[model samples]
Target: MNRITITILVLSAAATACGTSRSATGGAREGSGTVTGIITLADEVSPKTGDFCSGLNVRVTPTGAPEDVLGNGTVRTSRSRCSYQIANLPSGGESLAFSVKLPAAWQCGNGATPTVTPEPQTLQLRDYQTETRDFRVSCTAPSAETSTATP
Candidate 1:
């Protein structure tokens, strides 16, 4: 092959190694960025799941993405801690929708309940970066339980 042709082939192969490149085998470095956040309630309630936050689930979807992209970023409460993280997200400026799920055991009590209305939040994320946002729910202890608290 001519020198020009060989040089072009080499450049093409090199460019394909970048993060944004997609290989013929459907291999690409996707989701090099991360998105993280916490879930909290106005009132403290007993964690139904061991040390972890109970009656909670988190779902994150790419903003303006197609419906077929379901289940891209999804997590359920199980371990200790109320925070969650979605890693390996594609780089560049992207948006996400954060939402939660609560079980029946999470009492509404006398205080406000977790904010699930006003629409779930949409967060913008970039590659090789982490976005931290918290979601507050209006949850309160039972009236009797709260009243009986030690002084």
Candidate 2:
């Protein structure tokens, strides 16, 4: 019981079994993985807006975060509708790219028939798999222009 306290108790049980033998997957490792999605609004009328976007802003650039923000970077929705979501992320195994900005003059039609004709536009998403990927966005505005008005 004295060899330097049994070699410091066998190096503290081998450093707690190498920190619990690693294995969480979602934390991505064995080939790495992660990516979740949801950003809607591919109809009505929308195309020329800013303020970081009104109803959707799912940004991600993984592969070891090629410039900060690799998970839950941006995600917002309202401006009447058009879903939005971006969680966890960090799996850029397929060179990702997703962009949807609409809220300036904001018009995706069908808000009650604002010249209804599938007006809104501006929806792009690549690689896919932000959990499942279900994006849509269209641009257009007017009719008292509202959608949070702006910043």
Candidate 3:
């Protein structure tokens, strides 16, 4: 065989070997997941002004790894229901925490402070899995009243 042909064959074999080695040593793979859900307000407390959903900020991060944010999304308000989705998250046997930031202007139906159910939730995600987690914001009226009269 000619020297040029021999050299080409040797380089090709080395390239193939390197590729196989990288894969065997935990190289990048397709194992991303997604998290999506809706944010809803109580029927009685639906905001009457601007879009309340727009004020919400959804975030997902590796559990115990707050500095490493995996994904983030904002709520898209449609009438009464608001939806959000965070996609393309690495999901190889990892736990993720989901949380939201409430708008400061939110107020309850009965003139009370509003609260979010399941303020922060964590779940285990697998490859190519799409997890659904819903959140609700609601509040109840204060049962006790304070008297301002003084003698």
Candidate 4:
């Protein structure tokens, strides 16, 4: 074979090998599963009567994988905007955590992400499938009581 043709074949083989190596090293494959969740608040008042998921963020990140994943939350919606989704999550023995962020003007009663029933509200996803987890944050405000004395 010509020298040029031989070099091209070698290069192509090398490229294919590298691609396979990446996939073996946990690179995401086609049809990866998604991690979807919704953030609801536990309060005396209902979200419909008070606040919705609008302007709120539901953040999801793989546990101990890295810092956090991007594009994992929902945006403000005209109606109820509480659902959040993290697409293309590499499924394995991996688990994910969900947290909520309120707008600057608002704050949770505890001033922190409420401890959802599941604690971190994690999801164990499987390949080519979607996993769902629900998180709850309390928006209830501290109540005040008054006392009166008469003489």
lDDT per model vs. reference: 0.57, 0.46, 0.73, 0.57
Least accurate 10 contiguous residues by lDDT in model 1: 66-75
| Ranked by TM-score, top first | 3, 1, 4, 2
TM-scores for every predicted model: 0.52, 0.25, 0.67, 0.50
The Cα RMSD in angstroms, rounded to one decimal, for candidate 1 relative to the true structure is 9.7
Q: Highest TM-score among the candidates is held by which one?
A: 3
* Positional deviation of residue 88's Cα in model 3 after best superposition, in angstroms: 1.1
RMSD of each: 9.7, 13.7, 7.1, 7.1
Candidate 2 lowest-lDDT run of ten: 116-125
lDDT of 4 by residue, 77-111 (tens): 33343566766665664666656655554445454
How many clashes show up per model? 8, 31, 0, 0
Which residue ranges in model 4 land beyond 4 Å of their true spot? 1-31, 40-55, 70-73, 76-78, 107-119, 143-151
Model 3 lDDT-worst window of ten:
22-31
- Give the better candidate number (1 or 3) by lDDT: 3
Clashes of 1: 8
Give the 10-residue window scoring lowest on summed lDDT in candidate 4.
22-31
Model 1 lDDT per residue over 5-68, tens place: 9999989888886756553223343556666776665445444455445445665556664332
Cα lDDT tens digits, model 2, 1-151, are 6998989999999999887764332344222333444444454545534433453445545334434434444454446344445554434354444444444465545554224223323222334433445555543443575487566
